[model samples]
Target: MIFVTIGSIFPFDRMIRAMDDWASAEGRGEEVFAQIGDGSFEPRHMRWVRRLDRGAYAEAMASSRLIVAHAGVGSVVTAGELGKPIVVMPRRAALGEHTSDHQVETVSWLRGKPGLVVADGEADLPECIAAAAAAANAGARLATTADTGLIERLRHFIHG
Candidate 1:
């Protein structure tokens, strides 16, 4: 079971489409599932789940061997905490889901991090998916830039 969730805020239709195509071609007959918010994504081979509760979401993450998602820090942190290898794709601002092109920067930062693979475009997604599909293959790595220290500091500021 290959579980994928694209947070409603991200532009992930392209990535979803590519994954669906690959799943069919590879003939692995894998079950690809996701949540389609904004009613934009037309789920094909991948089953479009209408919604998932928090427990369901966490369970899904736990069950998944490969977690592909947008370059959101929350998702990255959760996946990392669970020790799941994640393939992150940034949502481009030009595509109109974001206020600016910050996700590209986020993806870049994550790409440099260990235990993370950033899939920035459609062309890059299939390979990343394949690499992850291979058991215990972490794929190409650049550097590990994820840090929880900043998050802790931010929490202190918020609570202060």
Candidate 2:
């Protein structure tokens, strides 16, 4: 299943709407499910809930073949730890989706990380999703542990 989530703090209607439209256009509605948050735009093509409980949320992530979500650190980190491929769409402040454009900056910083793909705008979502799904289907996976270099650097920074 393709699990789509907009974190608990804010409503991300644009991302939700884009995914909903993509599901409809691709005829993959049944395969898509969403945790939409407080978004005003209800998904017409796929199943969705306003919010998911912790257990349910974890289950959805665990079972999904691909995860589509807003560019939040928690979601990105969890996806990496779970070895799941994720497509992230940053919430834009210019659209009043957040208090600032930090999400966009976060996406920029996370650009080349394993198992994470960025959808810069609604129009970019479909292609990003497709690429992430294809990679997942091809057995590409994120490492469940931190990179060796990162770990070593942290160790040195802390203990030196």
Candidate 3:
């Protein structure tokens, strides 16, 4: 199963639509479930919801074979902790998908990280998904070292 998420703060119809189209065309027999935020593009090829509750979100992530998500820190962190194969497609501000290009910066920093495939745009998504699927089949797991460091930093920042 491929679990797709775009977080909850913003609508990311571009990513959702791309994934839906890719899944329909690829016919790889993988089930896709998406948490699409408040996006307007309705997925035709995969199961999707506008938003998921915390428990449902956790359950989806835990059960997913691969995670296709926007390059949000929260999503990345959750995927990292779950040790899932993740393909990140950053939302572009120029396309009105985000408020800024922070997701682009995030993906740049995270590209080549273990268990991650960064898709620069919709065109790269299918290839990245294929890569993620291959990695998952090969038993690849993301190292949580970076996540641990991030947690520590957050803890200090919050508690200090």
**Candidate 2: residue 40 lDDT (0-100):** 92
lDDT of 2 by residue, 1-160 (tens): 8899999999999999998999999746458999999879999899899989999999999998889999998898889878899999999999999999999999998886667889999999888988887887777776677789999999999999
Please state the error at residue 138 of candidate 3 in Å.
Answer: 2.7
lDDT of 1 at 51: 65
State the lDDT of candidate 1 residue by residue for 1-160, as single tens digits. Answer: 6667777564467767777776677626677677655546676677767567889889988888778787777778877777677778887878775788877988876664656777878778777776655533644332244357987888899998
Clashing pairs in 3: none
TM-score of 1: 0.78
- Would you list the rank order by lDDT, best first? 3, 2, 1
How many clashes show up per model?
Answer: 5, 0, 0
Task: List clashing residue pairs in candidate 1.
Answer: 112-143, 113-143, 113-144, 113-145, 114-144
The segments of candidate 1 whose C-alpha lies over 4 angstroms from its true place after superposition are 133-160
> What does the lDDT read for residue 142 in candidate 2?
65
lDDT of each: 0.71, 0.89, 0.90
